[model samples]
Each structure stands twice: as C-alpha cells, then as structure tokens.
Target: AAAQAAAWLAGGGLPDPEAGLKWGYMEGATDYLFEEREPSPGVAYVRLVPVLRAEPTGHDLIDELLREPRSWRWDGHGESMDWWPAVLPSHREVVAVNYLPHLLYQWNHAGVYPPYLEALCQADGPVGDATAIALAYFLSTDAERGVPLLLRMAARGDLPAAAVGRQLTHLIRRAGHQTRPVVAALAVAAREGAYEQVWEILRAMLPGLLPGEGERPNVTHTEAVTLAADVATWAKAGGEVPATVSAYAMSKRTSRFARECRRLRTQLT
Candidate 1:
C-alpha cells in the first residue's frame, strides 16, 4: 500500500492534477493566488489522506536497545555465575539484526557472553549475525574455541570466509598471547573444510608475519606463518593457493613486507 501510494505520487500527483485542483489562468499566466471558495456541485473529489503513524522496524528496535544498561542480573545469582535468563530473550529478539555481535555485547552486563554465544549459534540466526558474534567473542575474550564455530558459520554462507580471516589477523595483532590456540583451531577447521576461504585468510596474515627492517621475528609472527602454510597446504585448491598468495605478496606496496610475503609464498609453492 505504501509502495502504491509512492508510485501514485511519482507517476503524477497524489490527488491527480487534472481533477483534484481547479486552476485558473489570468493574464496569459498561471495564477498563483487562485483559491477555491467552494467546490462546484456534482464534481467528485478525493477525500483528505490521514497522517501516517510511524512504526518501528527491527533496526529501530536494535537502535533503541543500544541505550539499555550494560549490566544485568536476571536471576538472584550475580554476574559470576551463569546468567542464561538475562540474555536469552535478547538473543532471540535481536538475532534478526545482521550485527548481532554489537547487540549481544551491549546487553552482556551480567557476564553472560558465553550463553549469548551459545544461543546465537543454536538459534539458526542470520549467518552474518553468527559470524559477527564469533568475531566479537574472539576479540573480546581471545577464545580460540570459537574459531571452528566461526568457520562453521562462515561455511553456512552468512558472510564471506575472508571476514573471519581478517578478524583473525586483527585478533593476533591485538592479543598475541592467544595466537597459538587460534592458529591450532584454524588448522583444524581448514583440514575439515569447515570453511572455504582459507586462501584469503592466509593472504591477509602475510603482511603481519613480516618484520620491519632489522626487526627480529616474534613468536606470534612465526606461529602465524606456520599456520598460514598449514592452511595453504591442506586447502583443496592445491598449487593455486600458493599462486594466489604469491600474486598478493608481489603486489604489496611495502617492499619489506612484499619481499617477506614472496618468500613465504615460495615455501608454500
């Protein structure tokens, strides 16, 4: 109905120009001040349209929820214990939004992050939401256990697998301490084919693996490099994976990083 009204307005006029308005010409020009004192009898006219009432959409609801207090305790127990009830309803309600991670974290005052994660993973929500949820979990908690789950979500096509890879790189840069576990989890996912964009993930990680001039390679950098190699080897694309990585490495703007990427690409080849 709204579309029809918009279409009607677009095609001509809302009430139609020919019949609705009574125009008069004066001095060979369109009289701007013409007004109808009264309608002539026997002429049919359109009734006035009522004002439209604004209704909230799912996005609107999510916005309204942003102002909600972060801390929560649904049951008698405090944030230390499992607080399933505090976030279950919200998970069900906000899963429709593509950015579920932000919504979930906003409402995670009671330390129910895990429960929110479990609910989102099990609820059959949008794939983007699930992917966001996984990335959010990894960034906030550095929990590698979520990697495979993220891979599964990516496999479902809610979002590109490259997004997960990019987030993994971000996670490593932010919290290098958790690098080992994240890499291990990613290796397992790749071998199992839980996600298909292993090549993209490796490519994004290449620059990070390179050390600046005269700088020594760190533990996290070496671990990440090994992980990327493992993913490239196990990936179904065979030699094409190395070729793609080599192309990206050669195209890099930073000479040092580019040289490093090409070297790594050679090892894979």
Candidate 2:
C-alpha cells in the first residue's frame, strides 16, 4: 500500500514543478527534527521527509534504505542485505544464509558459484560489509570458497574491523569445533591490527567452542583451542575462562591444547 502511494506520488500526484519537495528526499534530517519513535502506542505519525538533495546514488537497495531512514528498523527486520532486491547480478540465492549449507551443495552440484564472491574476494570489492557478512554464514563448511574469501578479506583489510566484528563472532560460533582454520586465519588478521576483532569473537564464542560434554577433543578441536589461546595472549585479554575450559586446564591431560589451556589458566587467574 505504501509502495503504491509512493508510486502514485512519483506519477502525476505531485503538486507542481515549482514545488521544491521531492518524494523520498531525506535531507537536512535530524533525530530532533523528526519522530524517532511512533508518536503514540499502536499509532504511527506522518513522516516528514525533507528534500535537500535529489541526485540518485544509482543503486536501488541503497536508495531504498536511504529513502525511508526512519522506517528502517534493523532490530525489527532481518539485518541481511537479502531483505531487498540487489542491483548487481550474482548467482546467490537471496535470503539463503540460513539454508547456506544446502544451497551451496546444490550450487556445487550445478557447477556454479555466487558471482558476488569474485568481487568480494578482491581488494576493496564492489560489495558492502553487509554482503560480505551475509555470505560469511557458511564460512566454516565452505572450505573451498568462503574460507579463502574470508582469509583474503581479513588480510587485505577489505572491510573495517568494527563493521565485521559481530559477524566474525557469529562465524566462530557457527564453526564450533571446526574452528581451527578460521581461528588461525583470525590470528594473522589480529597481527594486522584486528586483535580487537579476535578478542570480541572469543568473548562471544569461548564457552561454546569446547566439544560437547564427555566428548574428548579431536585433533582439529585441540588446534582451535591452541590458536584461540594464542589470540587471547596476543590481544592481552584476561578474563574468567569458561568453567569447562578451566576444568580441562586443571586436568592432567598433557596435550598441546591442554598445556595451552593451563597456561591460559595461569594468565587468567
């Protein structure tokens, strides 16, 4: 309904050519100047869109997002770039991040790739941070493609650490026990000035990084732990290690990871 209204306004419903107002113009807008929240419970106030600039960005999704800035609620709506149509061509199935493992399998069988990856993997690719993050959901299992792409992005500093921090945390959480490669890759990125990003990911993922109860750590799992400890030390981050990790650190297991965990215990203590 609102789209139709916008279309009608774009059509012949505009008042006059002399009138300076243009539809969807978001200029001279400040939170104090406009309503940040609904004026009343269960009621929305009329939006005041001030027109200060009329030039288009030549990108549709960017335009729409900037169109109704007040109406965009990332907290309420899905934060993926998949919520709207993209202007660029790509083999990606939009909104497929949750089903990425399955979608990637099908794409592999069909011998195709998400075209956006080509640019995203390059230095300062044409894509934005949201696109890179959305695609990162499958990074751990997507060893052939997504992992390499992530490594390159981190190495080149293609996106700001702050912009990708939350997604990086989620990436490690999704990886679980298979976090060795990603953690190792992140250690390199940390030395390149993303140590803060590594620390944030560990804070969010350490408790869950361990194997399930009563299950011994596999080779890959132990490697992940060792790399995580290295990152914690590099970041000089000292906090209470999760109870499970602390318990294992106290045990007499003499493997590389157990030793590292004990060292971590000494530092964190």
Candidate 3:
C-alpha cells in the first residue's frame, strides 16, 4: 500500500508484482514529495520490533519492498482478488520494518534526522548495538541519512565518536561533488545550536572535502572551502581550520579559496 503511495506520488500507477524490478520510483514524481512531510514522532518504530533485524537494513528492505498495489480476497468472492487499498493484518509489522523506512527516506531525504533510527543507533543494548553495527557496516546506502544521525548519537554518548568520525569522512568523500546539501545540513544544525556536535563531524569531513593540505585548489575545492566557511561561521567555531585550508589561504592572496579561507579562519579566533 505504501509502495503504491510511493508509486502514485512518484507519478505512476502501482507496478506489477510479476513485472521485473523498477527504477528509482521512476523520477517522474509529482510535487507532493517536495511538500516537506514526515510522520509524527509517535509513529511506531522500536516497539513491536523484531529482536533480530533482517540482515542489515538497506538492500534487504528494498528487496522485500511491496511494489504491487495492495488488495485482498473475500470469502464470497471468486478466486480472483480485489485490488484496492487494503492491508492484510499479518503484513502490518512487515510494512513497518521493511517499507516504512524507505517511505520516510523518500519524504525526508535531506533531513535524515529520523529519531527512531537515531534510537536504533544506540550502543550498549542489543537492539542498539545491532543497529549501530548494521548501519556502520554497510554505510553506502545509509550515508546520506546515517552519517548525520551517528553524529547526533555520538554527541549524546550513545555511539563512539571515533567511529562516527570515520563514517563522516567516508560520507564526505563518497558524496564527492554532491556533498553540498550534506554540508548545508550540518551548517543548519550548527546555526540551530548544535555547534559542538556539528563541528566534530566537520573536523573529520572537511579535510577530505577540501583539496589536500597543499595541493592546488580547483573550482571543486573552492566550493568545498566556501561551504566549510559557511558552516564554520554559523557554528561560531573555535578551532583551527584544516591545514589544507590554511595553507591555501596563504598560497594565493586573492583567489576564491583564499577568500573563503580567510572567512573560515576568522571564525576560529
């Protein structure tokens, strides 16, 4: 049912079950997805959850996704079933764990701040540890969402800072040129008073995002430095800019990178 909603919102009808796989919701999505929607925090997640997650949480969930329109059989009806909006009682929990995350992800791709997932990223308890390990192990699917979640979790002493830091580095590198929104999210978080938590993630992320310590700066690097400066300024950050940034600031007196470095460096003092 949710998958149909995904399909409908994505500008298509429900996909056939017998039909082979589908593309990323067809990219023909209507403007509904951009309306800024998310489920209430009260929506069920940890409660009634399976003690053992089904083999990590990304691909498997996608594999189990319900793409066909939901329908059901009636006792009086012929063998053919009715295809409309209906949920089989048995499939409730299945959808919660398997389909809900993806739906939530589609809605809040940039926010990536799902509290339930954050709750799952706990360290000590079995559920928490399992989730933390699962998310960290195959972060390629989780990077956009999981990286920032880990930062917040680590800040609260729920997960390890070093490990979270490493993932932040991986996220920055993996995102490559697309790291703009990710960086913007951090800056927004800092501007909203998450300075220390955001800075910790940035310290790990910035070096890789920037050109190497003394390597020649390019347009890409220029953008990276500018974004970092935006973050540092918002965070009111109090620490050294990365060596790469500092060296570049000194390398060219008037280039864009140097100018961004000056703005970034000033925040440190």
Candidate 4:
C-alpha cells in the first residue's frame, strides 16, 4: 500500500528478530509480513505483529461511524475514504466525512465547537491519512483558524505538504470552498524553508489547473488558476523561494529538473 511505500522510501523496514527463517511469501503476507535484509544470519525472518490500531475499551462510537455511508476515491498512492458534508455528530479521531456538515452545524448552533476542534487538533494517526484531510477541511470553514493550523502543521512537518494540497483540492471539489487560505498556508511553509515539500504539494495541484483535451474550464479551473497565480507571485518575492521558482533560479544545479520547472513556470506565468 502507499503507506508501506512511503515507509520504505523513508528507510523504514520490517522488524525481524529471527535469523535464517521463513523468507518466502505466504497467504496474507501483504497484510502482516515485511522483509528486511540480514547479512549476518545469511537470511532474515519475521516478528509477530501487534495490534497497531487499538481501540479504547467500550468504544461505542464505532457504531456511529459504521452507520455513515462508505465512499472512497483512489489516487496514484492509494485509496482515500471519506463521507460527504464533512462533519460529525460526536467528534472522534477518526470521523465520517459525510456527517461533517451536520456536525459542524450542530456544534456551532449549540456552542460546542471547541470540543470538536480540539479533537481534530489532538487526534493522531498516519501522516496524510483520511482524518488529517477531514480536519483540514473542517477547520477550513473558519479560514482564520484553519489556515494557520495547516501552516503550523506543515512547518513543523506534522502533516505532509502533498497531502494538505491534495486534500484542499478535494475540498474544493466537494464543498465548493475557496482555497486561497490553503495557498497562503503553503506560502508560509515555503517561507519556512520547506521549498522541496511545497513544490511537491503544488505539483499535486497542477492537475486541477490544466484542462482536459476538449473540456471547457469550470469553477474549479478558475480556482486553480487563481491559486497558481498566487503561488507565482510568492515565488517572485524576495523572501524564501518556492522550489519551482528556485529550480528556475538555479537551473544549472545538478539536483534541479529545469525542464519540468520551466513547463510549470510557463503555465503559471
């Protein structure tokens, strides 16, 4: 899965304790087994898996989550599942995207927004997971709060920039919300010297900016255009530069991909 791929890319490997043992795949291998090289033993082995996601005892809230509709979308990385309207009745670390509107409405009307927001802020899980996306969208209802929250997370490396960008684009498609705040958050991250991560995030947003072969531009297209324009302006500023801008600035650098940066620069310009 994408998570596994990410772990591998970051130099994470299986926790194998046994030497010269089962090294071949078995049924359900993908679900439980991971392989690591062990030169000392001339082979590698496995460790018994533990419950990675443990639920609190008497966690009755799961019933409410199960009752929500099950819907998801696949990306190059993997699947992302979320419910519509993006709110929840009782805030939990994991939430139903569909119930968010109702949940937010009730919370606001009942003067209980803090508990829900607090839950989103404190809830922990995998990086760039569904809950993170939901939190970004839910917090976005109040940009003053949401934008800074996202920026802080990105700056601190708590949330991946690509995840935040993709989730913001998804939010635009589902909620018809503006993404200016999100773009600004990205700019803040760029200023904090996260140029490489910011560039990947912006690259994820590029699909939204370009039109299909024969399709007419829509509201989403316009929003994407506006986002790109803002990013371009930030790129030209005298402060910390965005990766796209830096790639063009340092085209001779061996690490930079000049052609790709030039292509995106041409579009944004």
Q: TM-score of every model?
A: 0.47, 0.46, 0.43, 0.42
State the weakest 10-residue window (summed lDDT) of model 2: 16-25
Worst 10 residues of 4 by lDDT: 16-25
lDDT of 2 by residue, 1-269 (tens): 56765776476432211101111112334332222332223322222222222234444643453332222232323334332234222312121222222221232232224444544344222333344443444344444565455556556655334324444444454322246655655555566565655565555555656666887777766665676676677778787886767888989988876887787676666
Identify the superior model by TM-score, candidate 1 or candidate 4. 1
lDDT of 4: 0.42
lDDT of 1: 0.43
Q: What is the C-alpha lDDT of each candidate?
A: 0.43, 0.46, 0.44, 0.42
Q: Please write out the lDDT profile of model 1 over residues 189-254, one tens digit for every residue.
A: 666675346555666555554455566555655555666665555553334434334654678455
- Candidate 4, pairs of clashing residues: 83-97, 83-98, 84-98, 86-100, 87-99, 87-100, 87-101
Q: Which ten residues in a row have the lowest lDDT in candidate 3?
A: 18-27
Which stretches of candidate 1 lie above 4 Å from their native place? 1-63, 66-109, 123-133, 139-144, 175-177, 236-269
Candidate 1 vs candidate 2, lDDT winner = 2
**Best-fitting candidate, scored by lDDT:** 2
State the TM-score for model 2. Answer: 0.46
In model 3, which regions exceed 4 Å deviation? 1-116, 122-162, 172-177, 213-220, 230-236
